[model samples]
Target: MPRVSGVVGHVVTFGRVLRQAGLEIGPNRIADGLSGLDQVDLTRQDDVYWTLRANFVTRREELEIFDRAFQAWFLRTPVSPFELSPPTPQSAVLRRIHAAGRPDSAAGTDESPAARGWSYEEILRTKDFGAMTSDEFDRVRALIADIAAERPRRRSRRLRRHHRGRELDLRRTIRESLGAGGDPVHRQYRLRARVPRKLVVLCDVSGSMEAYVRPLLLFVHAVRGSGKGVEAFAFGTRLTRLTRALETSDPDRALQDAARSVADWCGGTRIGASLKTYNDDWGRRALTRGAVVVIASDGWEREESGARLLEDQMARLARQAYTVVWVNPLKGHPAYEPLAAGMRAALPHVDRFLPGHNLASLERLGEVLMGIERRHAA
Candidate 1:
């Protein structure tokens, strides 16, 4: 917009672009920024970066984008390059030499500079694990797996291996030892302290629930792969049994297999029908005696009949399993309530209704599982 007209036109054009990009900068802020630029000492590249950053950057992520755009658009051939360390005398020498290499009398420069390194925490903090770019999301998922791996395992009954460690069962020992000479031999008895046995996950991959899907899936995969008592499932349009899919050691292969089984990825949620299907077909089969059922959804079922159906299924599941926890993402919100039709209908039957949004929420879930495991162990 400015090239044909002149320097007078460029300032007007820049203001319009910044406003369109969600910045609150108006003619006043632009004037403030323009005036502020003159007072700010920006001899160093980073000093120029900070000068613009202080005037323009209101949010963290914007700093990175604004930095890049500012540098490329304004300071095409900056007098100095950005220094990671301080603007030292040595850096000044290098800057002067670099500047000397370029045309000393360069014109049409805005004197603005780019921001520093990419805004890792800023862009990433808002990113949902499932929707991130492959490499970026993989990093998050790997972190989730690492965190889950580091979590302390729950004390389950299967872990009680020391049968003989209690008061030595003299009566039983003598009875069994009769085959040999009555020698008080050290007979070791071990408990089945294996990983969690049954894991029934009802992930809500609906429109609203997409943000948490990545980390959530990573968490599910971590438990399922641990060779504990785990059977994973994903529910959207219907109930998907992912037990076999998760058995594969490779995360990518496991997820691919799971994706193959899940005909409905992100669609309308039918929690009631899904739970009913699980109850009718696989409930007794999967639960066996008792299993841990974690339902990861926002409790936004579109139908009350479905909610009721889910309630019935949850009731059945509650009886067959060690515990029934409803992991609702909305629960993480400050002003959240269990007022949704799905939540209202199902909350009555859930053993626990917990949040599943951030690292802290996952840690809380781990704690809850520990307590549930202890109760079942006894």
Candidate 2:
């Protein structure tokens, strides 16, 4: 075992060797390896070896090459500090691999920086959240903030002062007419007031959706910062409101607070029961009230009975909400279909069923919200 920084460099070097040895390794795979390394016990040789092998060696044939490269690069005899130059003739295969998948120099020279630069960001924007490396995930946080800032505002029922409203302002018209011997010469009209719509987010923080919860919560925080009325909730076995937790201006701190507040971070999902709790306790008071409800889940319920409860609650939510947008991260997969029991039961009640697997999909959601606002205003 070595320092995390040292191990990451060696892992990247190891990936290069495998590629040169005829294995089809890419930068994404290398990044994935580094991410895997971070999660495992680096001190354990077996843990370290498998972490690299899992990311770089995909095919059965590549395993032999990976073993040879791993032994040659990491397990070989130590050379003198002064002898540290380029790879030797025996190590040329690995050296050439590194050259082929070398990360851009413009990006910072760090383990996390391995997935930076504009080109990387472009790829990351559309990349599925479930497959993203730790570095890429970190970079996308700022992008999420920007997307949240662009979310559309909904019009409110309350009217505000307007210069040319359809309805006449009789009180104002009379006050002005007093100057002209009470003659109705000019008329003033009042228009409906437009306020930012309330955004209620019910995110599933279950084990199945572990990869997506962080990014989705960050999205919730962004929505809150956009000055809209945002109520955030996380559910696994039960529901926990995160509106106050996510109020911190700092994204990282807000997430930490939310994590602390939530009792079930990555437990089993009880979508139906959580929604029922929301509907029973908070729906009329804070959740509905003309708010747009956004539920981020994969639609996997624990039991058949839960699915039935979920369907009823979703139907009730649909009736009260201005819009019911279901953000399922699984929808991003090309072959994916909403055939899960909970998904099937709830889709009928959903107004906008969009993918929530990447920044691009979330941006499309922003567009969808804007469209709803435009239609409402019209």
Q: Over 4 Å off in model 1, which ranges?
A: 1-136, 150-164, 167-197, 286-288, 374-378
Query: Relative to the true structure, how large is the alpha-carbon lDDT of every model?
Result: 0.63, 0.78
Clashing residue pair totals per candidate (backbone < 3 A) = 14, 2
Per residue, candidate 1 scores C-alpha lDDT tens digits across 5-121 of 343244456555555555566677666565555665644667656665677678774665566556655676343333322222233222322332243323344431223224563
Candidate 2 clash pair list: 17-94, 159-193
Kindly give the stretch of ten consecutive residues in candidate 2 with the minimal lDDT sum. Answer: 81-90
What is the Cα root-mean-square deviation between model 2 and the actual structure?
21.0
